[model samples]
Target: MPKKDQGLGPSAETPLPGDDTVVCGVVRHLGGDYLLAKCMDGVDRKVRIPGKLRKRVWINEGDIILVGLWDFSPDKGEVVYKYGRNEINKLIEKGFLSKEFINALSEYL
Candidate 1:
């Protein structure tokens, strides 16, 4: 049997990104090596994980992440941040992330 708290996974306090530099997005699909994300602003963008994050973060479809948009094109971006379960719950409680997103996240968990 699994422990009650064990299902919550590991806890890490990675800081959430500033809205000016990065926006929160939900990973909708994986197009080959790229991630198709729909941002909170209602824009669907193609995102690639930068080399620095590639070695450290593990992203999958339906995960909520932060993406820094490209300067030249509005339709592309880079995944700069990953939100852990604890961080996500905090975001929901703090009103940074919408309640609907949390509902969707619960389906996955």
Candidate 2:
């Protein structure tokens, strides 16, 4: 299979059963390979977009996402949330996010 067409698979990156966990954050940086987001769980976690999953998801910095992961550290958790548009939109429109924040989120989509 072509590298470009290689969709995010089950083998991409899995945060054991206890790394870290949360569901929202601020985009801090868009790295050469992955994204760096400020987790809302009060844990300063630097996220990474797994090799096979980066291009497949519409993940942007500053966008809030529903995360599901294990304990990565005392202040950070590994990411498992990839494509959660509906969830983000609902939270944004429900007054959890500002217009500017939502706009920023769109840039990644």
lDDT of 2: 0.51
RMSD of candidate 2 to the truth, in angstroms, is 7.1
Residue-level lDDT of model 2, residues 1-109, one tens digit each, is 5446443544434322223345556466546654555444445456655544555656666656545444434444345655344555655555554556455445644
Model 2 poorest 10 in a row by lDDT: 11-20
Cα displacement (Å) at residue 47, model 1: 0.4
RMSD of each: 7.8, 7.1
Q: Score candidate 1 by lDDT.
A: 0.69
TM-score of each: 0.69, 0.48
Model 1 per-residue lDDT tens digits across residues 33-73: 47777666767788887776765567877678888878888
Taken over the whole model, the C-alpha lDDT of each candidate is 0.69, 0.51
